[model samples]
Target: MTSNATSSGKTVASAVRDVFERIYGDPLKQLESLITATGLPVYKDPKTGALLWVDVRELRLRFTLSVNKLEKFIEGLRGGKLMYTQCRRCGAKYFPPQVDCPRCKASDVEWREVSTEGELVTWTVINVKPASFSHQGDYVVGIVKMPDGFNITAWIDADPKTLKPGMKMRLVVDRRPGEGYITYWFKPAF
Candidate 1:
């Protein structure tokens, strides 16, 4: 397999392209199929038995992100380390990583590895997800207070019923499966 290809033997871009093709194959034919399947552009939910209307309008979005200022943070992820930025002048730390120190009005900042240990502040379970995350089961998002006095928000890779505030948490660097991108998340320390 090529370096850019995933274990499934398809590049991430190709997988996304396939999904788009399936969703938008001849709009008129899709509408006809839907109408024939349900006798109209409406259907009854299997679980709730509520009538649902099918939307004919479709929106496709593709965008690019500019990470020029936070290049070091991305590099740290590639290197298997979690990094944060700190203001050299006033000792202010940033988790999302800021290029300039807003507190001290100084551009000089220090890049350092973050401690994996943290405390869970709060969390919530997302039952209804957006289109992109619909494939996955319900997930819990949490805010963790790091030792450096900054909070990082990420998905908690654990059961939500067992979580509580002030519980020990650890930050971990990992690669997400479908999108195949490096990211960080929190998990129960013990």
Candidate 2:
């Protein structure tokens, strides 16, 4: 069987593709026929009585994201440091650093290192993850309110039961487990 790349460094063999088509193709074709007959792409669930709309068009987006404006942020992660952008005109701050100031419409900004400590404001345990991230298993995602008055969303490397609102969390940048890529996370301070 031939293999084809579904994504970067990920391949699906022809046999697997054929099996998937066999499993799902019939229902999809039936749905298409229903849409053609009804002139509407809506269906009602038999068990839940919920109406569902299926789009006639399928969009697959794959593109490269330019990080030219936030090069410092990327470099900071490689150096085990986190950075943010602050507007020189309005004194506003932003995480996931942006070069343009949307508030004042000024492109002038400076990059600054982010505080290492923050307080956990909210969190959630992600039991069902996206296909790309399924390999990592269940994980905790949290929003930490940093000392600088900005919140950063990241994976929390801790037990969910042990976490509480207002608990101190320390930002960490290092190689992610089993991924071999440098990324950031938050962990309980105490």
**TM-scores for candidates 1 onward, in order:** 0.75, 0.69
Q: Report the lDDT tens digits of candidate 1 across residue range 1-190.
A: 1224346654446656766566566765857888988778876778999988878676668889899888889899988689999998999898888978878799989999999899999999999875556545788999999988899999898999999999999888866555566788888998
Root-mean-square deviation of Cα positions for candidate 1 versus the true structure, in angstroms: 5.6
lDDT of 2 by residue, 49-158 (tens): 99988877766555789988888999998888999999999999998789999899999999999999999999999997654455556999999999986999999999
Per-model C-alpha lDDT, please?
Answer: 0.81, 0.83
| Alpha-carbon shift of residue 86 in model 1 (angstroms) | 0.6
How many clashing residue pairs appear in each of the predictions shown?
0, 0
Model 1's lDDT to the true fold? Answer: 0.81
Q: What is the lDDT of residue 73 in candidate 2?
A: 93
- Model 2 residue runs over 4 Å out of place are 1-61
The number of clashing residue pairs in model 2 is: 0
